[model samples]
Target: MKKWFSSAIVFTVLAVLVAGCAGGNTKSGTSESVDANKGEKKPVIKILQNKIEITDKVKAMVADYNAYNPDVVVEVQVVKDYLTMLKTRFASGDAPDIFTTAGYNPMASWSDKLVDLSNEPWMGSVSPLTIEGMTMNGQKMGFPLAFEGFGVVYNKDLFAQAGIDTPPTTFSELKAAAEKLKAAGIKPYKEAYQEGFPLYHILNLGFAYEQDPLATLAKLEKQEMKLADLPFLNNVFDVLDLGMKYGEGQESLGVSYDSQVSDFATGKIAMINNGVWTIDPITKVNADINIGMFALPLTDNAEETKMPISVPGYYVINKDSKHVEESKKFLSWLHENGEKYLVDSFKFFPAFTDIKATDDLGPLAKDMAAYVESGKGITWTQSAWPVGYREDTVKRIQAYIGGQGDREQTIAELQKDWDNRVNK
Candidate 1:
């Protein structure tokens, strides 16, 4: 699960920090001048982020801020597997002034190292669901940067060619459609259990089985409920079973996200269960592909149910940041200006209710926007799960998909694990 970080890079960073901190104070004139300048003033804010390439819009925004604010300087560093880097920095007492956490578990674990932004001016602009995901012990520990919705992203042309009139809105219909596509010589659904995350994406659809999964999750955390007692887990097993039923072949383990996406883009697959992030790959293959989206089709009342949606990205400030005010100012600007950047660059739907959907979005994005406006969507499953349970549950799903485990055994294991963790 932590394969994102390479061991050599971690060792190199630790070595550098150790060497820098262990050096004696042999003060040269230049060093003294630098220290004096630091004391006298200009605020320096360091930001640690994953090594994702920045969009031009974000770069332009940063440039504008840098040109205007001479008193504060922002230095951005790209860290591979940012969470590992964060842990290393925390151990060394050299963490950045600001960083990003993937979800609630990491946020909760590092809550003591983050500043509570509940009173921040921009807090009111965010949604209550997002606040709940980012808050720890009733204090806001992070600010959501963007929102995303996931479902079956399908090629309209392919569906039409297959004589399918509409997207599936229920589990049975979805299975039938997959079988039809398969018989038509097109893989009905393309999944990447090899990546691990995509398997979790399928399990997340189980939230739709419950009346109010989010509320139930909260109760489970308080020991008022057990995940095993819920019927949703069984429904989730059925969903995973569907994916395995239509998977490509025996070498499914060799299938990566890129290959699955490529197959979908090339019209080899009718649909793929993914979020807005899949848009880029689709566009790259064929910008003209007519794309459409629908929820997992798990619920009986298709029109009344909403797809699972949540903030896809987050921004958090370091608890030990010396320039807290400056960091907060940057965060404010980020919340205000970041939406346009997301829309223009990544086509991400902004979580801010006041923000309007732009015409620049792809067909699928536009459809998802309408879905959200209908107020039928729920929060992302991973975001709502208790700390430590999310990843373990995902691994279980992967094991099931690989045919190494059974649904009952998987659910029983998860129930026991979650029960133990929540109790502890």
Candidate 2:
């Protein structure tokens, strides 16, 4: 553990204290079951999540669970500004009964708040890959949802039409692909830069494509290397420029993420950036679209490209919640009955070992699956970023891409803000 991060964790304790202390442990399931059996009111289990893609599927799951069980009520709430809201709720000591948790260092920061689910009944039925992805220091903090990957999603048919036979592996090749697509009178890509999160996701992959991103971040934490001195940040700047220069005009600044997905699904653009969560919505628009994904190569060799793949998020129970036991039972139910929902409904690759993929997870996800199976897939490391890093960095990126600033200014802002957050 880095010294600065220890101080950061200590801040969270005072945060929740200044906010308020939580009430007692939640009503246990046995009592709730007894009340329901007596035709009395059932206890409610509240779940908060950030997965905007599967809102409908989760709602349906809640409905189905309520109908069959009839002993406890489950309420699902989608937080649009989930990550930001997650920290606020936690600091306020108002953490939800069960909230979605990310993997890696970010999840570890919440180790004190989360009830370890490693010894839960569902652990035996989950895939070892998932268990590994969600575990930290031998303690599993939450329920792993699925195998996930993200990169640049492209139209294979468009590539062929543009006389490009292969996805770009290096930065130069990506530039060439864009030029060919532009020459073919088709836009090379579409972006929603106005949104911080989509931009944040790009930076995550861009930074990770470096020779050793984790090591680089560790050095940054230790004040050993400057962000600009590294070769990758420069490449990231050029890649940011790549998206902006070839993007779909000024209208793209305001293009919502859904619009980006719809446009890419309809083949209006040759490429887009996103993950497998876009699969269901894209397929719903054009199930037959020859969608493909490749790791965004910011280097000279395409063969070296490795897509980041891992458990993106998990379901965590609040240890201090008034509904801990109820939350546990609710999660156990999902573990048992959610196999089909995980597949047909959510369309995510199931985290459970008992469930098998009847068909491919999706077009892009197929490549992601292969990468993970080969042990070449990278883990999404942005989950380790400090809370305000995304908001701060994205603003600088938006300014740079929008032609309002230069690389020096952007990098300066990044280093300054990072230092402020850590040193505070």
Candidate 3:
């Protein structure tokens, strides 16, 4: 793989960029629209988050917030290239009043740029995993808005038509289901590998299930172990090859995430391996589409496979924003009285304790909650990887899946890239 952004250069840029993310006295931001119902302008608190699925929902929620509380307005922006754009905004010295962070590793780069949200009133009600996931070195940096999971999101109607009674629970069953769907002349799975997000997700979850991810990462971080030493590299490569072989057309390599979601909603594909966040976009295309979720079965032992569930992002007040207090207040209001509005507005499982959305939960959320409740949920640790780790891993996986590389060589390159990143 080509040498890309090194750890030193990234940290160097982050050191300089955090200062750029500092906001000045004036609030320059993106609001939903003019508050036609209100007579006066309100103090605007801008938000920048990565979940594009909830862009409209958050806009409406903020509108509702504005309607009730006219004193302040919260503007939400959901970007595709969230990390890069956030850095761009920060470097321009026009950071949003509030921003979203993944968790410890990425947040560590900007720890100084975020306000300490340890004292947030809703923190007590938030899921411990959500809170702990965002915490770094005992500092509570942001509010985890949702407890999310990713697996095989499938079409129930399609599965039923193929005589499959339940979602696949084993890697063998998963491939069998895909074969049945393929035989039925339906594209078994949607692929969007040209985009790095899904590509990294498939491999990350595969390896996550095969090892104690935190322990493995700890050993690797200390140079006590090597990626090549991990016994699950073959299993990860197996899943990657499975997807490359049985999924949709070769052109899928160039497909975008939106196209994947849109096509799936139309019932063209039997399943997709993506995060629960894809539900919103799918429902937007066909609200009544029959959907279900199962852990991406990476093992023959159903008992061993765990759903990849964890907090994807957190809301943090920008330390340099002049409206820090107001931004916190707005975020506080989001969790006011159990965040029922948020639960209703979006289908996600709420991180807040008081909200129990049993009846209204979406299919993917229900599956994720079941795993979390049953202690079968695994952590999403890609958030803890180095900045350029995704690109490096994706390139190697892409090469192998493309038949241009072999498993042993791929494993060696991955280990070399990771070791170099850590040592540098």
RMSD of each: 8.4, 7.5, 7.9
Q: What is residue 200's positional error in candidate 3, in angstroms?
A: 1.3
lDDT of 3 at 323: 82
Number of backbone collisions per candidate, in order?
Answer: 1, 3, 1
Better of 2 and 3 by TM-score: 3
Runs with alpha carbons beyond 4 Å of true place in candidate 1: 1-41, 51-57, 222-225, 303-305
The sequence of per-residue lDDT tens digits that candidate 1 reaches over residues 236-339 is 67766677678754356567889988988888887887776677778889777888888777645666445766665567888787878899998887666655
Off by over 4 Å in 3: 1-44, 70-81, 183-186, 248-252
- Candidate 1 residue 268 C-alpha distance from true site, Å: 1.0
Structure candidate 3, residue pairs in collision: 20-90
lDDT of 1: 0.65
Q: List per-prediction Cα lDDT, in the order shown.
A: 0.65, 0.69, 0.69
Give the higher-lDDT candidate: 1 or 2: 2
Q: lDDT rank, highest first?
A: 3, 2, 1
Q: Itemize residue pairs with steric clashes in candidate 1.
A: 306-376
Higher-ranked by TM-score: 1 or 3: 1
Give me the candidate number with maximum TM-score: 1
lDDT of 2 by residue, 326-402 (tens): 89988888778665776656666766667665454566656665655555565455776666676788777777776
